[model samples]
Target: MSPRRDDVIVIGAGLSGLMAARELEAAGRSVRVLEARDRVGGRTWTRSLRGHPIDLGGQWVGPTQDRVLALARELGIETYEQFDRGRKVMELGGQRSTYRGLLPWVGLGGLAELGLRVGQLELMARRIPLRAPAERADASALDGQTVRAWLDRRVRNPKARAVLRIATEMVFAGEPEDLSLLFFLFYMHSGGGFVRLTSIRGGAQAQRLKGGAQGLSRRMAEALATPVEHGQAVHAVLQEPEGVVVHAGNRSLRARHAIVAVPPALAAEIDLGPARSERRRRAEQGMPMGSVVKCIVVYPRPFWREAGLSGESISDGEPIRATFDGCSPDLSFCALVAFVIGGSAGGFGARPSEERRALVVEHLVRLFGAEAAEPVAYEDQDWSQEAWSRGCYVGLMRPGVLAEVGNVLREPAGRVRFAGTETAARWCGYFDGALRAGERAAQEVLEAMRAEVPGDV
Candidate 1:
């Protein structure tokens, strides 16, 4: 039988791929979307816990992430602020403390240290060109250094260092030692700097979808004229002089253009042949997904609130390093969402499931008191273990790689264009970034089609 044909073929049904497909549809072009997983939404997932909806994956939306917020509104999805009404708990270096407002402020000394270093990061972020960061004059120097090495050289306060370490992991889901300083700066700047990325009231964790973040993609999928093709993971994308041929499972489809919207590593896995661009191959090898385990513990009530606690905890403790209140906007159910991230996520996730739960309970007990002992239920999503997604949140660029080849993943190779959160210059690791990337890739394809066939766009 002849292969199916479409104007454009979108690989991966994540936010980026969906967005790309949606744009192509808006432009009156035929589009076929293929997804490996049976479901859509990619990294953002929301499941039920004891009859209450709980986000198992990426969930938060914040200030300056206007694109996603607008999308939610357009899709008729309401959003609410993340519960941050009381004291935040901190367990650092075996010491436990509670404080109100944004940070747990390491100490007056640590405060000064954090302030100066964050200022430096923000300043350095402005220096690197957003489009082709490798072209920056100081790119070589900044990209060559790991975030860990840079911190070790200047940050003197141990507590402040620990806080920054946790913050970096929470943001990038990669250990500081594994991240490039230049890449870190770019991520921070793209998301509106250090404070906005970390804080609650005006930060990245500020707001969440009333239903769930995944609803954004689900709604888009429903609206698209053509249904998303799940369980058809593209194994190869062969660009041809006429168009493109995509092979997935036993099926082959031809299209005028193709958009590859999965993570850097996964996109690299698709057999693009020896003719594939060297820079894309390098990017695929250089970028690895960040490790994380998002655990949501359902409780009978918001117990920590009774103790004048906000349920926000940051610790140097094991098994669980950070937690936040995971209550619904209407306060229908109470839950505590915790995270095991970065370098420690692997070891902690390696233990038996029950053991992981016990450790999380124990850590929460230490910060929020005995009330945290008993929870109605416990659920965790180990992102690294997921076959479709080797990791979560975003992909990390190895040291010196970003400088050598700047944003190569975004470049279109023949009839193929790429779109993922990593390729977005704005809000690079967030859903907003993914949306922006999808829109940009779709526009690129649209322009190319118009250039080739004139007025078809």
Candidate 2:
């Protein structure tokens, strides 16, 4: 059979790729989306656990993430505030302390240092341009150092340093030593500084979808003129003079342009023929995906609330780093959401499922009470183990890598363009970023094909 034809061929059915296809469709261009997984939403996934929906992927949204928020509103998806009432728990130096509000009970000295360093990092982050962070004058110096080195050089207090480390690992899913200082600053700034990104009341983790974040992609997929072809992993591409041919399984397609919407790690699996550049290879190799395991446990009731606990916990403990109260608005569905991030995720996810669940229950028992030992249901998504995604949250840029390959990230590899959360300007690792990146890639394709139209989508 003749290869399928379209104005644009989109790889991956995640929000970014689907958004790109949406924009293309809105612009009167035909599109065909190919996804490796047999579902939409990409990293944002949700499933029913014991008659209750559980979000096991990127699920949070806030007012600051205007793109995702706007999309949610347009899609008629309701948003609810994250549950954070009663007392919060904090474990430091092997001591557990229950506190309330944003700042934990980490002592006056550590608190002061925390405020100082956070403010300092925020200020530094503001100086980095969103679109072209590498082009900034001091980019070289900033990119040359890792967050670990920068923290050791700048932060004096151990408690403050440890807290910052934990926060970075939780957010980026990469250890301090694995991330570039410049990239870290840019990422935090992209989400409106450290305070906003880390806070809950009015920050990145502020809200949740009534159903789940994955619903965004599901709705988009359903509304599209063409259905997304699932289980079609684009393994090879050949850029012809007139168009491009994308190969997935026994199928192939020729299009004026192709948008590679997967993460760098997955993108590396696609053979770009002889035109693939060494710089692109280096960028893909240097930028590694962060590790994370999103866990959920459901019980008969929200017992933590009965004890006047909010179910939120932040700790420097091994394996488990953070957790939050994840019950329904009516309090009928009681569940504890948790995360094992960074280097710890590697080891934690390697354990047998039963052991992992046991460890989480044990940790919660200590943080909450004896009630945590028994749960009606348990589930988790080890993002690192996913074949299509490889990892979660977003890609990580190591020290010295950004300075060299950052410029080439958004540029087209011949007839192939790129889009994902990593290519976004603001909220780089969030759903908003993913949408923005998709829109940007679609616009690029339109401009190249001379079909550009203003106010599209």
Candidate 3:
């Protein structure tokens, strides 16, 4: 039989690919979505834990992320504020403290230093262009230095440095030594600012969808004319002057254009024909996903709330680095969501599941008391173990890589285009970024189609 044909073939049924398909369909184009995994939502996944819904992947939607928020509203998905009602915990250098407001119990001097550093980052980030950071005059200087080196020069207090390190892990899921200063600045600029990227009250993690983060993608998939085809891992993409053919196992799909919406590293694995640019290949090879293990522990009730604690914490010691309250609306069940990130995640994720759970419980016991020792259920998603995902959160850029090949991030190779959170200019590495990138890719294909077929527009 001849290959199935469509106006466009979207490889990967994640948020980015689904958004692209949605846009193409709205523009009177036929679309086919192929996904490697047996599910949708990409990095955003929602799973049940002890009869309670828990987001095992990307879950938070901030206030400044208007695109995703608008999409959620359009899909009739309701969102609720993240639980931040009581005091937050801070554990640094083997000492734990509780504070009612945003700033933790860092010393007055440390707070002042942190404020100064943030101000500097905000000012510098604003000056750097989000789309083309390599073109900036100071790009070479900034890109040459890692975030760790930059922090060393600016921050003198140990507590302040630790806080920034934890912030870097939480945001990028990578160590400061592994990230470029220019890339970090560009990321902050893309997401609005440092404050917006890290805040919960009115920031990037301000609200979460009622059902889960995956609801947005699921709803989008439901509205599409073509249902998503899962378990079809694409192996190669062949683009010619007339059309493109995507090969998955024994099956093949032909289309006028194609969108490769998987992570950059995963995209590199696909066998795109000879038209693929060396720059694009090198860029993808250099961009690797950050490591993280998302852990959700469910309890019968919100035990910490009775102690006047918010369940939000930043810790320097243990298998987990951060914690937040993930209780469902109406207080049906209480869950504590924690992140094991960076090198710690690598070590912890390697151990037996029971051992990892014990460590998490032990750590929580220290923070929230003996009540935290027992839970109804314990679950975690080790992104590194996922065959399709390899890693979580988003991809990261090392020193000098962004400056050398960042310009080719969104450029199309022959008839094959790219779309993912990594390709977005605004809100890069977030749900909003994924949607924006997908829409942009769809627009590119639509414009090309119009040009190819006069009067189509």
Candidate 4:
């Protein structure tokens, strides 16, 4: 039998879709959420690998994140502070250097401090819509330049440049060479920069999920009573006069409105009929996603603590981009997470899994010692492999793209609404942005529905 006609049909049960469904349901609207994957959390999933629950994707939350933190608080999900134990190690220009300060660079003592202050300034700058950042009007001044170029011009110290590159890669998911200076500046301003951004204290500040993010989504689904049909890949969307139809295999759903909660790259596949414009075509082509390869190697014990280092290392300009001491106090397990940004991750893609593990193990052994090489278990995720999510976070506009067509992908198209980390105004590419976009799209739909007039009983 055909299901009863619902008030709204939301596609993709990611953080955003769930949030939109929750809001719509709270307002007494009937809603159904559809997910392409067999799981509920979409991209944000956590599972027991080997033994520990290392987040496979979409980890970390911040206190400043009003939506996610509020949801966590409501669900009673607790968070733990990041375990930043010991001193950070630096590998630059083939020489290994150990630093005992807040930042990994030397002369950056002043520039890093300035960068912190600039991040604070950037947060305040968020008051101005990203569509028009004052500095952005002059594309030659900021837009045309890559983050690496901006940093190089600002910080004369090569070490400082390298440290900033690591931070940029972590945040933007791209190298300094490709990231826009205006984008980074706006990112800093929106969230108050590096220091304040890191201090969200359980919200942005901690990494514990209590049970992990997937649990939180389940609670949202239950509260909304929204049926999330999993393993159903939406092949096409056909808009009708009264409602829109979603197609996948032999199954199809018709709703008054459809939320395109999937990422831009994936959303490109959905045929919007005549509404699909060249702008979206360019967005699908121009926007970039990070080719990220994260390796989570857990040891029988926290051996790195004995190495007189913090277990965190930043490469000056090497393939071993960044490493951190992702260990708990019990010492039963130690996680060394290495982030390979831009072209750095390409080499590891074709390598065998065991070989990939061996490569990271060798890097750790070279810096921390042979003990670091031994692992009880290892887990890795290449987000690129995900058909649903082609890459991790949305790529920032390279030089020419942002200046010419900055808001092309963010605009709404007919009855189809877009949401995800990329559409958020504040934190455009973070998990927080994902939550923000979901909330914003939900509110937009709610207001629109409430304003609608009934046609028939």
Candidate 5:
């Protein structure tokens, strides 16, 4: 069957692309989705490792993330909460404090409370818009300062700082030193603040398709009655007087509109006809990729649980940095995921996979006793090294970027609209951001199609 021509061509089969295609298809418009990877889900990839489904790519969706939750529900996918079992351990100043029988803030109760107050204050600060918020008036105060700086001044407890640091690391996948406080604030605001974050149940908290995240994309494509052409890496996107032509391998696809949903850094490489605007260029220029190394270690068993440990640990030391009990609840499998971000992750990303695995093993053994060293399997995804990804995710404004060029990313460039975690107006670096961006881009395309006019070039 000749690829069914469409009114719009949705590039990338990631969540954003799939969502865009679905939206266009629902509007009585034919659509074709071109995916570069052989499988669906793009950045959200789940693979079988050690005879179990392991999501090595995008993982976890909060409850308040309406776009993703709505899509998951639409597809009949279910999510579970991440495990917060056992006692959490914290390592500070070369001292390991194991909370054998205590609350989460046992080690730093006062500081934890203080940090909550500061967090509440920061949350209030974010409600003000970047364009009109008083915070923006003092934007210069935060521009050059990193999350570390802001937290240090605002939060007195070292343990509290560590917790917040972990949150920042997981969310941005980079050092807080590289991300803007304003951008971070906006992120919290977008989700309606800390009170709203939710995870899948059983410490298995993440809305996973009954089959897998990949199944969600597959089902979405089926619902659209569109065959997603996989392994079709888009090379060039050219504009014609009548429509747009997309070159993917040897095949050329034409459509009245095209939604460019790849990473901003990657999307910027594709040449657009009529050229992109200064604002778009600024957005693209300001939009840089950040790095994060998600290392997964499959344990022979939940040894940490046996040790009266929560499988959650924070370190001011080496190797593992932080460890989480990523195992699915039923105790069927045990997974320990460690995140190395920014400059720290860079070193790990550059190292050979085997060496990196060894380093992780050493760290796990030290933190969780010797049992952690005997892993059934070990794997790591250096998202920065993945050519298609360039980096794990998009970078937040370094001080000046967002103040001067941030809004550009939120703006559309001609017939070419952008979608991805990076382009999200809400949560720019999380799975939620991808969902929001995809849904918003779909709405943008629908609105443009309705007007019977191409969107601003």
Candidate 6:
């Protein structure tokens, strides 16, 4: 049977794939997008709960994330500041404290120590280039050590160590011991700085899209000249000298170029013929996605706000590691979102839906008093359970993996290219990075095609 042909075929209808398709179509190339899920928006998902739109996936947009912010505006999506007024909550060693600003009632000495560590991280991260992390002078030594090992040697204060550990879980969705220090530095550098990566005002968690994060992807898909085909997961990619063939269940698509924009772990499942190099294959095997269970609890009102709380909290010992105010912009409905990440996510996500919901509600009640027990709705999306996406946020490099095989991440295999947030240099694990990578991959494909046969594009 003859396969349908196009100029470009994109596997995955996520933001990255959609953006790549948009660019190719704008360049006068025929394109088609194939997605495994019934809907678009890979890691970024928006859903309605009790008549209020809530983002179950990646939602926040930082000030430094110019790419996603600009794209949102271009798509006519508005943004709003996160509800971060009043004092924030912190629970450490079973003690609860409320404080205004960023310190969170920690001692002056602890705050100074934390600040110094953050400064040191930022300074070291600034010295490492994003594109060539493995080529650094001390890359081998740094990659050999874990973030936990680095913290153990330098951080003496218990409070400081706890704070850093929590930050590690929130950012990477993995424990400090699970990821390499070199990768952490490169990630921080790519996101601009440590402060920008963690803060709420100027950091990566600053603003929320007016509708939802997924709205941007929906708009981009809508604007595309070629429609995205749903429930068509590409199982094999056979790359030829002049083109590539992508095969899903009973259907196959042939294209001049192909973009495998799914997660690295998922991409590893596809058969790429002789084009996939050993280095690329080994790198994909080593790159594991971080675990996270995003839970949202809708309430009658922003009760924590009236109690002089900012609806944000971090815990050293809680199933829900972090909490944030997910209320609507119009203040009509209230929602509190929490993240169960890392090892806890694995345990909690494995439980039945009712059990997980009860656990989350119990934790929220403990944090916000008895008023939190009664929620209008309790919804959670366990990314680890999804067949298409093994996990959430982004992939992580364990100790010794980055130094050995980090350079092959974005390297193309014949007519096939990669595009995802994980392959991005700037804002490596965010929606912003996803957009940058998509655009970059599209440009690379266009350049390759033009170089191969002049005026082909």
User: Candidate 2, residues 1-457: lDDT per residue as tens digits?
Assistant: 2456898999989999999999999999999999989899989998998777789998899977888999999999999999888998888778888987666756789889888899899899999898788888889999999999988988888888888988888889889999999999999889899889888888998999989999999999998999999889899978988889999998778998999999987888899988678888888888889999999999999999999998888888866799999999987789999999988898899999999999999998888889999998899989999998899888899888777877576779988999998888889999999999999999999988884335543
Tell me the spans in candidate 3 whose CA falls farther than 4 Å from its real position: none
**True-structure RMSD, every candidate:** 1.2, 2.0, 1.1, 3.2, 3.9, 1.2
Per-residue lDDT tens digits for candidate 6, residues 1-457, read: 2466898999999999999999999998899899999999999999998777889899999887888989998999999999898787788888888777765556888888888898999899998879899998999999999999999999888898888889889999989998899999999999988888878998899999987899999999999887889989889999776788889888877899999999999999999988888888878887799999999998988999999888998987668899999898777889899999999999898899889989989888878889999998899999998888899888888888888886787989888999999999999999999999999999999998899888675
TM-score of predicted structure 1: 0.98
- The residue-by-residue lDDT of candidate 4 on 359-407, one tens digit each, is 8888887777788767878888877778888777565566655556566
Model 4 segments more than 4 A misplaced: 1-3, 107-128, 131-136, 139-141, 196-205, 454-457
The whole-model C-alpha lDDT of candidate 5 against the native structure comes to 0.70
lDDT of 4 at 283: 66
**Global lDDT scores for all candidate models:** 0.88, 0.89, 0.90, 0.70, 0.70, 0.89
Off by over 4 Å in 1: none
Give the CA lDDT, 0 to 100, for residue 48 in model 4.
76
Ranking 5 against 6 by lDDT, winner: 6
Shift in Å, residue 182, candidate 3: 0.9
- Clashing residue pairs in candidate 2 are none
Against the correct fold, how does model 5 do in TM-score? 0.87
Per-candidate TM vs. native? Answer: 0.98, 0.97, 0.98, 0.89, 0.87, 0.98
Residue 293 error, candidate 2, Å: 0.6
Which residue pairs come into collision in candidate 6? Answer: none
Instruction: Give the residue spans of candidate 2 off by over 4 A.
Output: 451-457
**Can you give the lDDT of residue 235 in candidate 2?**
97
Pairs in clash, predicted candidate 1: none
The residue-level lDDT of candidate 3 at 97 comes to 87
Better-scoring candidate (lDDT), 2 or 4: 2
Leading candidate by lDDT: 3
Per-prediction tally of clashes:
0, 0, 1, 13, 15, 0
Model 2 has an lDDT value of 0.89
Candidate numbers, best TM-score first, in rank order: 3, 1, 6, 2, 4, 5
